[model samples]
Target: MKELFPLKQVMGFAFSIFFTLLALAVYFFNMSFTIGMTVLLVTAFLQAGLQLVVFMHAGETEDKGAIYTNIYYALVIALVTVFGTLLCMIWGYV
Candidate 1:
């Protein structure tokens, strides 16, 4: 029975639940825009990282370093794409 339970996965599940609840609270409560956005952003990033490391087992394999590097590259590209779009379309970069 003990061997059946994956402790790390359980912990990850709990943490994911916690982050979800926190996000819900931010949505339900009448928080200031800046505060709400900040909290939501922080929780969102944490949840994503937790999901990757725990559920996805991102660091368990022998090629973990390469995997992490690829993830980082993807993240950088995503950020750049988002910000560039915003700058050009929303912020009026010409």
Candidate 2:
């Protein structure tokens, strides 16, 4: 029974559920827009990391460092793209 128990996955699933509920609460509780967005963003990133590490087995491979490095690069690119767009289109930084 112990050998068959998927503890990590179960914990990850529970954490995911908790985060989902937290997001729902933040949405339905009529929180301020900025605070709500901040909470949601933080929870989203945490959930994403949990899913990647627990479900995706990100640390199981020999090239785990490369995998994490690539993920970081992707995140940087995404952030740059989003911020650049916001600056140019919304903030009128052209």
Candidate 3:
């Protein structure tokens, strides 16, 4: 069936490959470091999410909500720790 074929998944894979190639092009061509890094980061994050959701079916199980909640909490904590360090150390806000 078409579901088994998963055209959407194919498209997502193609897009991932395209973004990877684009990143390589930026690197090989010696483009602006800031721009290249930004693009690479964006694409890398997006591809990771796509792979998680599509291929891994991260939210398909009954515990998906719990999983996502845990992820969110972890992200919040990470952000706080990172920002706190930057604030205290770099910004001299202690």
State each model's C-alpha RMSD to the native: 1.4, 0.8, 2.4
* Candidate 1 lDDT by residue in tens digits, 1-94: 9999899999999999999999889878978999999989999999999999999999999999999999999999999999999999999997
> lDDT of all the models against the reference?
0.95, 0.95, 0.84
Answer with 2 or 3, whichever has the higher lDDT.
2
TM-score against native, each model: 0.90, 0.95, 0.70
lDDT of 3 by residue, 1-94 (tens): 8668988778878987887887788878887889888988788778777787778887899999988888788879988999999999999999
Model 2 scores what on Cα lDDT?
Answer: 0.95
Q: Where does candidate 1 stray beyond 4 Å?
A: 1-4
Model 3 TM-score (2 dp): 0.70
Q: Model 2 segments beyond 4 Å from truth?
A: none
Screening candidate 1 with a backbone cut-off below 3 angstroms (N, C-alpha, C), the clashing residue pairs are none
Candidate 2: tens digits of C-alpha lDDT, residues 1-94: 9989999999999999999999988978999999999999999999999999999999899999999999999999999999999999999999
Q: Among these predicted structures, which one has the highest TM-score?
A: 2
User: Native-vs-model 1 lDDT?
Assistant: 0.95
Tell how far residue 93 is off in model 2, in angstroms: 0.5
